[model samples]
Target: MEAPQQTEKKRIKVGIPRALHFYRYFPFWKKLLEELDAEIVISPLTNKKIVEVGVTHGFGELCIPVKIYYGQLLRLVKDHPDLDFIFVPRYVSEVKDSYFCPKFLSLPDVIKILPGIPKILNFEVNVKEFPISTAAVELGKQLGKGQNKALNAYKEAQKYFDEYHAFLREGASVNQALRLVQIIRPFTLPKKKSEGDIRFLLLGHGYNIFDTFINLDFQKKLKDQGVNHITIENLPESIFKTPVIVNPRGAKLQNYWRHEEEIMQAIRYFLTKGRDEIDGVIFLISFACGPDSLIAELIMRDMKVVGLPFLEIIMDEHSGEAGLLTRVESFVEMIRRKKKGLTVGRRNKLTIKSA
Candidate 1:
C-alpha cells in the first residue's frame, strides 16, 4: 500500500501557526495560497498541551514561541491527514524601509526543529525588494504551476490580502480587547477608542513591547503625549482559520514569524497611509532576538528617510527609564521640527504662488 498519487489527491493544505502574528499576516498568506488554489489549515489557539508537545518536539532549550509552534504542528499533522506541503513564506522585510527580527530571518530552519514537522516551504517574499510577483512565480515553478496559472493565483491572493487589510486598518483596534479577538495569539487587542486622538504605532514583539515592567513608563509617556498606541494584543478574530486540538481549552498562540509579519503590517500602514496621522512609531525588540536584530538594524537605517520621526530601542530585563526617556524626548522633538519645516515649506510655496 504505497501513498496516493499527487493527481488523485484533493487540494493541498497550508498550515499557519497562530501564536505570533497569525492575526496580522493571515490575510496575505490566505489570499496568496488560495490564489494558488491551495486550502489552508491554521492551528488553533495555544494551550498547555500545545506547549507540552512543543517542548517535547523541540530540543531541550528552544524558545517559548518555537515550543508553542511545535504543539501547533503536532495538532495539524494529527487532524489534517489530507494536508500536503506546508506553506512557509520567508520574509526579510515587509516595506521598503523595514526588516523583521533576526530570528524571523531563520523561520524555515526553525520550523524544521519540530519532532515530526510538515515539509516546510521556502517561499520568501522580500516585499519591496523582491515583490509578490517574483515569489509567486518561484513557488509556482516549484509546485509545477504554469506561468499563467501561477500569475493568476498570485494576483487573486494579492487582491484578497489588500482588501482584507483595508478593512483591518479601517477598524483594527487590537491593543485593549485582547480576549475579544477569537484568534489564539499571544496578545489581544482592545476595541477602538473615540476619534480625534493622535494615533501612534508601537512596533515590537508582544512580550517586549507590552511588558510595561521592562520598558517602565513607556505607555505612561504615550498617554501623556495624548497618543493611542496599538500592538499585537489588539487584532480582530478573523485571522484564525486553523483550529487547535491541544488541551482543548483553545488558548490562542501565534507562529513567531506570523507576529513579525503583523508588526510589519502595522508599520507599513503607518508609514504609507497614516504617516501624517501616526505621530511616530516606537520599535521595541529584545536584545538577542536574531530576527529583530536585523529588523532593528534595517529600521535604524531607514527611519531617517521615513516620512515621520521614529525610535528604535533594545529592551532587556534591566533597562533604565532615564535613558529611554531621553531617546523618546529626542524623537518627539524631531517630529516637532519636521512639522515646523513642513509648515514653513508650505508657506513659502504659497508665497511664491501669490507673487
Candidate 2:
C-alpha cells in the first residue's frame, strides 16, 4: 500500500508597521522574517486620515510619533486580515547606560491589548539579558520552525542588516538602501556640491526626521534650496556606541538617553572635525518630548559657546508647512550670509510652530 503524501504547510503571513523603529531597522526585520519563511506586509505610509484615526482612538497625551504608531497598528488590522502575527519587538536596551523610550518598551503590551488585532510576535531585545541570536530561535520555534532553520534564518538576516549599514556608511540614506535591495533603483549618493554650496547637519529621531507627512517633506525642501545635509544615522555606528565622555568643565555631559547619545555624539563629531565643511545645524524635535527638552538646552548652549549657527524647529500634528517654510528660508539665508562672512545678527532663538 502506498502511503499518502503529506501536504506542505502554508507560509505564515506577518505584518510589520512602517513607522517608529521601522525607519531604523526595517531591513533587519524584513529579512529576518523572510528567512523564517514568513510573508511580510508593511503598513502604508502615514497620511492625514491615519493621523485623524490615531488622534481620535489613541489614549493619553501621547507624542505625535506614538500616535502615528497606533495608527499604523490599526492599519495592519484593517488591511491584513489574514496575517497570522505582527512583529512588535520590545526594545529595552541596545547599549550600556542607554535605554529606549518608555513608549517603546511598552509598545508590544499596548498593541496586544488593542481590539481586532492578530497575535503579536515579540521578543525582548535587551543585549545585556539575552543574545540577539536567541530572538531568531525563539520566534522561529513559535512559528513551528526547527532550531537549525531558525539559526540559519537569523544568520542570513544579520548579513543583510550589515550590508544595509555598509550602504549607509557609504553615504546612502536609509530609504535608498532599502529600495536598492528590492531593485527599486540603483544606489546613489547626493549630487556633488558646487562652489558656494551649503552643507548642514540634520539631527533628530528617525521616526520624526524621515516621515514625510509628519515632517512636511522638510528634507525635500532643503534639497530644493540646493542644501546638502548629513544626519546622525549616516555616521559610523562605532562613534555612538563608545563610552560616554565628560568634558573637563563638567558642564558638558553625555546624555544617558539612548537615541539622544547618538545625536550628541554626531553633533560633537561634526563640530570638532567637520566644522570647516558644515555651516550650521538644523535640529528637528518633536513636541512633548521630555528627553529632547533637556537635550535641546544642552545643544543650544554648546553651539552658542562654539559660535556656530543653529536653527531649532519644533513640529507637531498642528504644524503648518507655510510658516515652517518661512523659518527655513530665513535660516538658510542666515547660513549663506554667515558663510560669506556677512554681519548677520544673532538670530539664536527656538522657533515654535503650532497650528
Candidate 3:
C-alpha cells in the first residue's frame, strides 16, 4: 500500500512597526510571537523616505512620531505582501488614574484607513481593566492557539521583558538592551566613558530620544563634542517612586499622562540626589505634543529655581541639521565659558584675601 501524503505546518507571519512602543516593549512581543511559532517581520529603521511617506499620508494635526508610525505601517504592507497579520495594540491605561497619549489610544483605528493594509491584530492593553496576561491569551486565540499554551508563552515572554529592563538599568542604551535580549543584533557595544569635564542629562521619551532619524542623531553629536550624557531610559525604576512637588502651595501633583511621569521623575532625581553628577540638561520635544508642552514649562521653572542651565529643542519634519548643530555647539560653548569664569572668580578672590 502507498503511504498517505503528509503536509508541513504553515507558520503565521506577523509584522510589527518599528516606531513608538517598539522601543519600549519589543522584547516581549518578539518572544511571545516566537513562542507561538509565528514568523515576525519588523519594519526597517526610520529614514528620509519613511519620513516623507509618513508626512504625506498622515493627518496634518498628528505629532511626528505618529506620522512616522503611518509610514512604517505602509512600508510593512508594501514590503511584506504575504504578511498574515499586523500587530497594533491599543494602549489605554497602564496604571490606575493614568492614561497613555490619546494618539496611542486611537492608533489602530487611524491606520486602518491606509490602502492595501493586511489584517491587524488590534489588542487592547488596559492594565486597569484587565491584566496583560488576559490580553495575551485573547491574542493567541486569534492565531489559533489554546489558552494554556498562550499563558505559557506569556510567562516566557515576561522573562525576556524583565531582562531587557535589567539591561537598561545596567547602563545599556535602548538599542543595546534590545541586542542583549537577542531581539536585535546589530548594535555596537557601549564605549567606556572618558573623563569628560561636562555632562548633560538628556530628557525625552524613548521614541523621541532614541529614534536617530527623528532626533537628527542628537546623541552621536553630543559624544562627538566630547560631552557625556544620560537619557531618561538609563535611570532605574526605583527613582520614580518619589513624587515631584509641582505646585507652589506644597501640594504634590500626580501626572495624568503615564510616560510624562518618567520625565518628571528624572528631573526630580537630577535636581536632588544626582545634582552634582550633571552639569546641565537638554530636553528634546516634538512639535505640537500636548503633554510635553505642559511638562516643558514645569521643567524650565524647576531648572531656573536651581539656576541650572537648560536647553529645550523643539523638533518637527522641518527641523534642519545645520540649525541643530549650531544650537548644540553654542550651548556647549556657553556652559564651558560659565564654568571657566566661576573657577577664575574663585581663584581671584582667594588671591586677594591672601594678599
* Model 3 alpha-carbon drift over 4 Å, by segment: 1-7, 180-195, 248-252, 342-355
Give one digit per residue, the lDDT tens place, for model 3 in 216-323: 999999988888887777788899786555674866578889888888889998878888888899999999999998999999998998878999999999999999
Show model 1 residue runs off by greater than 4 Å. Answer: 1-9, 56-63, 127-129, 174-203, 206-355
RMSD (CA, Å), candidate 3 to true, equals: 4.8
| lDDT, candidate 2, 1-355, per-residue tens | 2343345567899988878898988888887788888888888889998888777777767889988988888888799889899889888887755788999999998876667888888766787787778877888887888889988988998888887787788878766676675453545676655633887788888998889899999888898888888787678776765654546477666566788878887777765766676788988988898888777887888898777788888999999989899999999988887677776255555666999
After aligning candidate 2 to the native by TM-score, how far in Å is the CA of 338 from where it should be? 2.1
- CA lDDT scores, all candidates in order: 0.61, 0.81, 0.86
Who wins the TM-score comparison? Answer: 3
Task: Tell me the RMSD of model 2 versus the true structure.
Answer: 6.0
Per-residue alpha-carbon lDDT of candidate 1 for residues 33-108, written as tens digits (9 for 90 to 100):
7667676777665655666776676665445554555677777777776667766667776554446555456767
TM-score of 2: 0.89
lDDT of 3 at 13: 96
